[model samples]
Target: MASSYVEELLRQLAEERERADRERERANREREHADRAERKLAEEREHAEQKLAEEREHAEQMLAEERERANRAEAKQAPTTLEQYLRLIQQRLVTTLLVESNPVNSASGSVTAVNEKFYPLELCRWDDFEKQLERTFIEISSVFSSRSLFPSETDILGVQRELSPTSRKDEQDIRPFVRSAIEKPAERIVRAYYDLTNRPEKFCFQNNAYSLEYRDPETEIERRSPSKRRSPERKKSQPIPDRWGICEEEGGLRRVCVGEYKAAHKVPDEEIRQVLDTASKNLFLEVLWRKQSGTTNSEQDKAKELVAQILCQAFHYMIQSGLLFGYITSGRTLILLRVDEFAQQRQARESEAQYAPATQLATFALLALRAREMPRDWIVQAENCGIYQWPLVPNPALHQNISLQPQTYGGETSESSGENDDPNDSDYGASQRQSRSQPDQQSRSQNERRRSPRKRTERSVGEYCTQACLLGLVQKSPLDVSCPNFSMHKRSSARGKHPITKDDLCCLLRKQLDRSLDQSCECLDRKGFFGDVGVLFKVTLTEYGYTFVAKGVQKANERDLAHEMKVYSHLVPLQGKNIPVCLGSIALTRPYPLVSMAKVTKMLLMSWAGTSLCYNTWPEGVDIKKETDKTLQTLAQSGVRHDDIRQSNLVWNAERQRVMAIDLQQATITSVTKRQASPPVLHTRKHRKIARSSSHIKGIVI
Candidate 1:
């Protein structure tokens, strides 16, 4: 209030100013408190958000760990490698070795045929074999294990074991107990053999179980008709082998070895002994001298004839099959026999009945010379070079021309115990000992006989014939100097006119849905590999019984196939050289069902490029890297570029005998158009003047 209340007003104004200051102080305090509260709320929110983020991260990590554990568990359950397979089979073999054991001792039979020496194979140390297996497994498994269509099963061994016979319980039963017990197991072991070493799968067992065209036991009408006129050869039973090894490496399955099985009592130990005794000498003398010897009993003479007839039968099979590797197994006892490589046996189909004996005698003479004259030391050395080993097979020229040596054995052979199933059994082979009987020694009675009239005595597995020494010999494939099957270029030479024309193939594929192309044809089996853009199936056909690999692609990737067919056409000269024979291409009338393929409109038919090439499947003497380089160079010359180059793309064409190039899908072609170049333009005065007019002088035309 105005000045007067001036004295009073001053006092009142001061009081009012004091009140305003107090109110201002109160407002500042409220604002400071609000700022502090807001800061505390924001800090609490950030702390909660950080805690939530940490929890989320921890949950994700737990999920990842769970997935890893599951994968590891799955991997543990299925055995993948051959090494693992070996362990599994080893146990099964041991368990089944003597499941239905029956002992029947055969009476001692006389042997008139001498055992001939063969390429002596050195026994492989089981430990060494394992190490070799490990090396090959590491190198090859990483590449082929995933894409393999090997048809492996966990219970394959179980199925194999069940194939044994349970009917023969008698001690003297003369049934084929071997088929169930030993033969099946033996075949599996041989199948596993390729994996145990670096050897390629050159052989496949052809057992009667698969290939035999069994007919009813001789009918009364057929038996009575033998004497009837006009005996058509078709009525006769085919001479198919009980067990034989066939090489698919040659297009047609060719028998390379034979096996004969008998009861333990059928082939006597003495017969076995005599065969091995003359392994490095003549065999015919066994029969000749024993028959002439007055000391031999009638029973012994009968035994001699029994063994002779059996051998003669086995020999005939070997001759006709065009092979010399023959084995005689009687469940318990195993006799691996190999004949001389150079000897010429007259095939029954090739020779007249009257001339057979003379031809056989000539064959025996050559075998006798090889046994008596081959140097033992040379054979031992050849074993290292993989030359002089059992089944000196395929061609003689492949191994050096060194005349082989035959080693003889001494000492009593220790029979492997029934319980001993060790693979690395290092049973030492017996060394040679002098067997010259003193000419002055007097003959003793049968009760105490030392020198009998017969020249040969009973012997066991000895010298080079020991099982240990035969492993290497069996690995090599021998060849004759004139053999077309062994020639590298034989693929082109051996193939006849294209089995089916492309025009014919198109018509055939049109009928694929009905499962019949040619008459009487049936799809026996099929195995397939599903690829990213295509599919491949190995189709086994009946009637002809030929197996072909059919490669197919959907309409989307048909362009790739078209380009591949064109590439194959350019590579026509290389067929049977560095690639397989492309039988040609076809378009399916219908969409073929493959992995996720609703429309497989393209098909490619080609020969098998053997198996995948790797350190394990590599053919001896072939350097894959060098071969690959050459293959690429050849492709370049043909004006093609293989955009995809890898070891996996190269295959071993076993039948064609070459490292083949495959999977030409990613390839690009440099068109080999032969258009001529235009003639060079000549400089004329008019053209020169025009050029001078167009050209301006830069600065000064020095």
Candidate 2:
């Protein structure tokens, strides 16, 4: 029994040892599974952190790029020097003048004069204001004196001093038909005219418009009559109008201003309006009326007619070519007209009683140069470039330095393209050669044909390469020397399979000009590039003859070229007559090859015409002035405004006696007037919020 019990104990001990082993194995398996899950979770967390870091970096990069773009835009939109100055004056000077001065009531004949008491002048440094005015006048005078401001001294087209008594005159009878009722004579002046003609001699003095000669009706009739042919003896007796009116030289009437002469008493509002209307609008009529005096009429009627005639004649002289100013006066009262069209428009608007009060004292005094005839005080004031001060109310003669050249370019034929072995040939000499070249449309392919790119895309890379080379050429060229004309062919490399590179296109343009790597063309406007847009150069071309080249490889320049081309296309018909004729244009398919640059470039070829007005004199034909005025009127009718209408832009062709316009880059074309005017735009609340947000983003206060 002892042996059996021992055996049973051994078996039980064996079973207990096996159960302990199984439990150890199960715990090891659970621990291994848990360790694997923990490792996987840790790996996932690290991956998620890396992705978040990358996303944050990308967002920051995007924000930086957007900020840079905004900065660039702001730089471009910044105001130019002249524009900034104008804004400053508008904000400060204009506001100050308006505050300190009283409203000029035309009826009361009260005018605001910026004298010693002018608060703005007293508050600020007089020297600074004077300096600004000097600069302003210099610019204005340079522009004005440069071009043909009036008909040449030799122009003889004359309006009859007296119209036929029996003729029924109407608006159509006016030389330049009054555009609107706004340009009518004042009723007060017209009524006053029914009562008086003081002696024109009273108003006539040296350098005054009143000194203009009066054409006698009887004499004019007698001379013009078919039966009144004059022999040598009779011819000597018949009066001939002086070539330069009453003045001995070219500029007899240097400046023209208007004035209303009242009897120093307070005029009625109706009379004042009538006077202004007459002075502004109807004064020109007196030029047409043949009768200045009535011999059979009573003294009152005779006086009335004479006064009207003399005033009209004086006004006519003031509006003549080379007019420095326009003004209206009534005894001590004075009002000056603004120079530019925009300023003039505003002045006109304010003149009407219906508009705002005459608070524009600064505009008249500083801008229009209006003041009392305090000659002694004026002398004291005009010391340092003071004679060239604001309004520069010019006297009859400033200077006689005529800069107009006789030839466009010297002695070279268009066939030669103004190219010569002589290095002394100037830009003017080349342009003279251009005057004889073929008319517009000489290059049909250049103007009309479009070339397909070797590799098709939005734009071709080959063209871009070509433009880059051209710009490089312009930068290195001179404007005063003549360039050789050479032929350029699209020749391939020895391999005959290589694509055209930037170097190749440049070489092609160089060859066309016969210009080697060391040689360059001449710049016309100036010797170097003034800005990023482009440089103006005198180029002799084999295909287009002598041409003025404007090349712009920068994006801004490209935009300017595009705008000019658009304007050129519109005025193509008037080319060589009143505008620069666009000969052709060139563009590279891609942006110029410059560092950090990815924009297209373009070049324009225009007919080499006359120099700017500064270098030329006014044509001596009244017809030309009339034509120019007509052109302005036509432009206005078309809803187009020549915003940059100034002397520099007016190019005068002495040979053809033509006045052509250049630089229409700042022109604007307005939308046509609606037959049924559209209701004013009203923004919804959501739109207003969006607008406010956009303005804020643009750094503009709405």
Candidate 3:
């Protein structure tokens, strides 16, 4: 039975071996197939690369050949001045074989040339050649002398002459003709060349070779019209009087006859001068009086017409003086005007009148008021008046007291007062004094009556208050004294009556209280006499609780007081480097607050310091130890040379002890200092002695 069992086990093993063989064979076959496929793809890629390279070479060769052919074609063509050269070459090449076959008809046959070589044709017509030459000439001329070929000045003058009046048009046209004549030499050379070489040709066909013969008469017909004939002149029409008038002809066309329309005789100089003087005076009065005194629209219209007439007279005067630049007559009015430059001078005169001086205006008003006796030179007299003064007084008493200067009008005689004058001015002075003093007396009486009752009540109240306190034998507090238990009392005692809740106060205290103060104090007891160090105390009341901070020093100074306030003011509700815990009367000052240092550090590092903290102490999901390790690693990598790495400055938070790099004025970011160096290595060795060998040797010797 054991043998059979062993045999069965051996058979099972063989079957397993056969299965392993089949699996190995299948894997090997897949790998070989993959290899063959990769080899075939590589070969196909190589073949494609070779084929593309061959095509690129072939394309380059074809492009080179095409460029060479273009170059040869361009070399055969030459620039020519004659218009018929291009057409002649094309016609000769196209009809050359046919022309050469009919040699007997050469004299009368149509001829053309290409490259200065003749072509003779028996069936070709001279009219056809002439037409082709004409068309070629026109095309060549257009190509050579395009629209831009004409001089700009000549073109502009031609257009202007077309639009000018008939009398001026002839003169404008003559300018361009004169310019064209000056440039005739160059034009003649071009014309001669065009006529000689651009004409139709005759040819001779001798010994089977094409040759040129005498030229044939061109068959082109001139299509331009002949010049018109001029008619003889008729007798001159009779002249009308030299006066300006507008005439309407039969077709309703209006014609201006200036000669017939001229005034029969010039208006008399004296009459014209009188009209001008009247217009000027009216215009001056209208402008000046309208400005001073308001007038109706009808009056203003009359004033404007008079001004227009004055302007017309001035314009005519300018024309008569030969200073008029131009004239334009519209109907009855002949506006003899000057250029804008000369008109500005006239405008200056009108503007001076329009904007008369203040003294001139005042003088005009005075003259108008005293029109009966006012002289024409009153304006000049007023201008010469050195100073004019007007006095204003509250009463006639004061007015009479002030002296008046005597007036001198052109050194004229003075008139004495008449019998109407009074011996005493007492009636007038008394009336003026009564009028001025009445209101003041009434106001004073009213004020006295209004105040009497309030004064009596105030005096009674004062007597009653003094009597009441004296009767009770108890003193009343002064008004300036404040009541007890007031919130203002604490504020006044600590930081003055001003509110201490302001942001500037908080900021100032926080910035100033970052340092300590030293103070000295002497103490005496029954047991012994001793000197005590006066410690500086900085206290701050925050949202959480009151904190009493003590700085251990020898004495207190101004800097200590400032530092205390600075640190105390910046303390958060429940945060800071050192927070005081209130234990009954005595407060226990902890090294740091139980607040998130990382959050406080972040708040302090922010661009604005007034924002709230973004972290909390004992924060969930925070690993303080891991974060501390990371911070240390980062600090090491950043080469931050930290000196004050104590628990106070390095606050412990839930996630991390935010390292507040304090006292940076003394610390620098540099290589590690001696205090931060690594510990030295120490080595110890274990000893194994050979004392047994010496003892055995001694026993053997015995």
User: CA RMSD for every model?
Assistant: 30.1, 37.0, 54.9
Question: How does candidate 3 fare on TM-score?
Answer: 0.14
Residue 551 of model 3: what lDDT?
26
Which candidate do you rate higher for TM-score, 2 or 3? 2
Return the lDDT, model 2, position 350: 16
lDDT head-to-head 1 vs 3, winner: 1
The 10 consecutive residues of candidate 1 with the worst lDDT sum are 681-690
Off by over 4 Å in 3: 76-97, 100-702
lDDT of 2 by residue, 232-314 (tens): 55432211111111111111111112322322233222233222222222221221121322232443233323333323222
lDDT of candidate 1 over 1-702, digit per residue (tens) = 565678897888999999989988888888888888888888888888988898898899898889888876655455444334334433443224332333443333432222331222211111222232234334434433443222233454554456453423322332234443344433443334334444333334446311212222242234436675434653644344456643332111223456665554555445444334323222223333344444445654455445444444444444333243455554444434343321111122221211211111122221221121111122222222332211123243432332222223232222322133222111111111111221111112322221221111121111111111111111121222232222321232224222333344434544652342222221111111334344554443222122345566666566556777777666655654565545556666444432111235666765555555532476688777787788788878877787866655676655455566777766777866342222111100000101111122111100
Tens-digit lDDT track of model 3 for 1-702: 999999999999999899889888988898888888888888888888888888888898888898887765543342333222222222222112111123342223211111111101000001122232234335435545422232233333343344322221222232232222211212322333233444221111011100011111111111111443323343221111112211111211111111111110111122222222223212322332343344524632343333333333332222111121212111112222221111101111221211111111111121111111111122122212221111111223433322122222222212322132222100110000011212121123423433331111111000011111111111111211122222322443333332232233324324322221011110001001101111212233222111222222111122222332222222221121111111111112211110000000000100000101112343466564564455445444444433434322233321113422221111234543333211111000000011111111110000
Error of 1 at 360 (Å): 29
Tell me which of candidates 1 and 2 scores higher on lDDT.
1
Minimal lDDT window, size 10, model 3: 594-603
Better of 1 and 3 by TM-score: 1
Where does model 2 exceed 4 Å of error?
Answer: 1-520, 525-534, 542-546, 551-553, 588-601, 621-627, 634-639, 671-702
Structural similarity to truth (TM-score) of each candidate: 0.30, 0.22, 0.14
